[model samples]
Target chain A: MSEIACVECGAEIRLDEDVIQNEILPCPDCGVELEVMSLDPVQLALAPEVEEDWGE
Target chain B: MTRVAMVITRVRAEEKMLLEVFRQRGTDPELIRDEELVINPSVIDPRWDEFDIVLQRSLSTSRGLYLLELFDAWGVPTVNSLRTASICSDKFKTSLALAKAGVPQPEVRIAFTPQSALEAVTELGYPAVLKPMIGSWGRLLAKVSDADAAEAVLEHRQTLGNYPYHVHFVQSYVEKPRGRDIRAFVVAGETICAIYRSSSHWVTNTARGASVEQCPVTAELQDLCRRASEAVGGGVLAMDVFETEGGFVLNEINHTMEFRNSIEPTGVDIAGRIVDYALALAAQLERGEGE
Candidate 1:
C-alpha cells in the first residue's frame, strides 16, 4: 500500500499496491477522482529505548 | 388514473411540452415544484411517497438535491432515476463514475478546502478548468491558463461566498472543439439524437449562448456516448463530448436534461418519447391496470 494525499481534499489515502499502479481511486474524504502514483512504502521508524524499565 | 408527477422548475417550454404530450396521451401530469414545495423539511415525508413516476427537467438550486434523494427513497420510478440524476448533477461524481467504468474522461480532481484547491491546480498544472461540483448550464466555470491565475481565482472564490466544505471537480481544459462540442441524447442505452453545440466562448453549453446545429452521428461518437452512459448506469441522458489532447473525453453527462427548441432540428419527438417511455415502463411494472 502507498499513502497518497487527496488532490481534492488533501486527506491522506492508503491506496492498495495494485490499485495505485493501475487503477484510479476516489478520495474517501472528498470523492474526487485521483490518479494514484506508485511510491516506495515508508518503513516505520523505531522508538527510542526508555532509560528505566525497572520501576514498572 | 395514470399518476404522473413532474418535478421541475416553475414552468418552461420543456415542462409545457411534457404536459402537452401527457395530455395528448390522455394522461394528466401533476406538476410539482419539488424545491418550492419544501416549506419544511419534514413536509417531504408524506407527499414524496404518493407519486408513481417522478420526472424532473430543471433543478438549478442546490436544495433540489434533497428532493432527488426523497424521491429516490420514496419507492417510485423516475425518468432518469435518482442515482443517475444525483451523479450527473455533481461533476466530481460523474468523473469518478466515468473513470471507474473505464470511459474516457479528462484527468480531473476535486477540491474541498482552499489548500487542496491550490494543490489540485498545481498538480493538474496550468490551462485547466475549475467548475462547481453541482453546477449546471456553464455557470461559475473558469478556465485558467497558469498556476498563478488559477490560485487567484480559487482565492477569490473562497472569499466571495461561504467556503465550500467539499472538493468540487477540477479538470484539465480541453482544446476548443473547432468552435463546437457534441451533445448526444441517449434513452435506454440507445442514441436518440446528436447535435453539435457551438459558441464563441469556451463554454459551449446551450444555456450559455451556444447554438445547436445538426451533426452527422459518427459510429465512434455514438459508441462513446453509449459507453459513457452505460458506465454511469443507464438513464435518459445527455452526454457532453469533446476531443481533448488525450483523446475523445466525456465532458459530462446530464440526467435531468432539458431539450427545448433544440430538439426541433433533430426531428426527434422528444416529448412524445419521454411520455411514451414513462407509460411503457409504468405498464411494464404491472402496477397500472386501467386504475
Candidate 2:
C-alpha cells in the first residue's frame, strides 16, 4: 500500500501500490476530488473538475 | 472460449467500459501496453499466441499504425485490420479511397510544399479547412478564410517542422446542416447506431462541446456507412458525415473511434457489442477463417 494525505482534510488515504497516474479517487473524509499526480513517490493533489472530452 | 488481446496504451473511460463489459461476461481480455513491450523485428513473441485476436485502441496515430503493421507482419489477426488502420490514419489516403469507392466527400487537395498549399487554398476559395494529414479530436485544424490566414497557417505548419505536419491536407469547408454533424458507428460492416453532434461551432465534434442526440439509422445511412467501411477494407469503423445543400458528405473515417458520449444518447451497449465482435473474430481465426 501507498500513503498520501488528502488535500482537503489532510486525512491519510491508502491506495494500492500499483495505482497509475491520472487515476481519480474521492477523499473519504472531506469528499474532495483526489488525482494521482505521479507514481514514483505516489503524489496526490486536488483534482481539477474534469469536463472529460477526448478526440475521435 | 476465445481469448483476446486488448491493445491499450492508456485506460481511458472508453477502454475501462470495454473491460468492465468483458469482465461481466466472464471473458476478460489481456491488456497489452506498447510501452512495456520490447519487440525483436520479424520474430514472434511467445506471449502473442495466448490471444486469438488483437483489438487495438492506442491513442497515438503513429503508434497505432506501427503496431497494426507489426502485428500484421507477424500474422496475428487484429480488429480494424492493418489495411484499414493505415489508410484511415492518413487523410489523403482516406480521400483517395473514398473517391475510388464513389462516396461523396468534400473537395480536398494535398500539397507537399507551402507554395502549392497556397495555390490549393486559392482554388478551394476562402474558409477552407487546413488539417494535419494525421490527427484526431480536431486538434491543430484551422479555418483559412483569406490569403493572409492561409499564408500564416501554412507558414506555421512549415515552422512546426514535423514531417507529418508538412503534408498539407486541405478540404473545402462544407457548411454543415444547422452547424451539426453525424457520426455513425459501424461494427463488422453493419451500422449499429448514429448520433448527431449538435454545436454552433463549425466543427461539430462531441469533444467540442457538442450535445449528442440519437439519429435513426435510415437505409441511406446504412448503405453509405457500409460503402465507406468497405472502401478502406472491411473492419470496424466510425463514419463522420456532414450535411450541406448538396446532401450528406462523408468527412472522415476513424479506426480507433471513441464513443464515451454516444452510449448515453444512443442507448446502445457499444462496449458489449465490441467485445462480442472481438470474440467472434477470434473464433473465426481459430477456425482458420481469418487472414
Instruction: For each candidate, give its TM-score against the true structure.
Output: 0.75, 0.87
Candidate 1 stretches greater than 4 Å from native = A1-56, B35-50, B165-168, B244-247, B287-291
Candidate with the greatest lDDT versus the true structure: 2
What tens digits encode model 1's per-residue C-alpha lDDT throughout B46-107? 65566667776545534455666666665666776667776777677788888888899877
- Per-residue lDDT tens digits for candidate 2, residues B1-291, read 667777765666778778778778777678887657777886778788566788898766667778888888888889879899889988999999999999999999999998999999999898899998977778788998999999999999999758878999999988877678999999988989999998888877786789889998988889888898889887778899987776678999998898989999899998888878887887878888864
Give me the runs in candidate 2 sitting further than 4 Å from their true place: A1-55
Q: For model 1, how big is the CA root-mean-square deviation? A: 21.1
**Residue pairs in steric clash, candidate 1?**
A8-B110, B1-B291, B111-B167, B112-B166, B112-B167
Model 2 chain A — which ten-residue stretch has the worst lDDT? A47-56
Question: Residue B71 in candidate 1 has what lDDT?
Answer: 64
When summed lDDT is taken over every stretch of 10 residues in candidate 2 chain B, the lowest stretch is: B1-10
Of candidate 1 chain B, the 10-residue stretch with the lowest lDDT total is B34-43
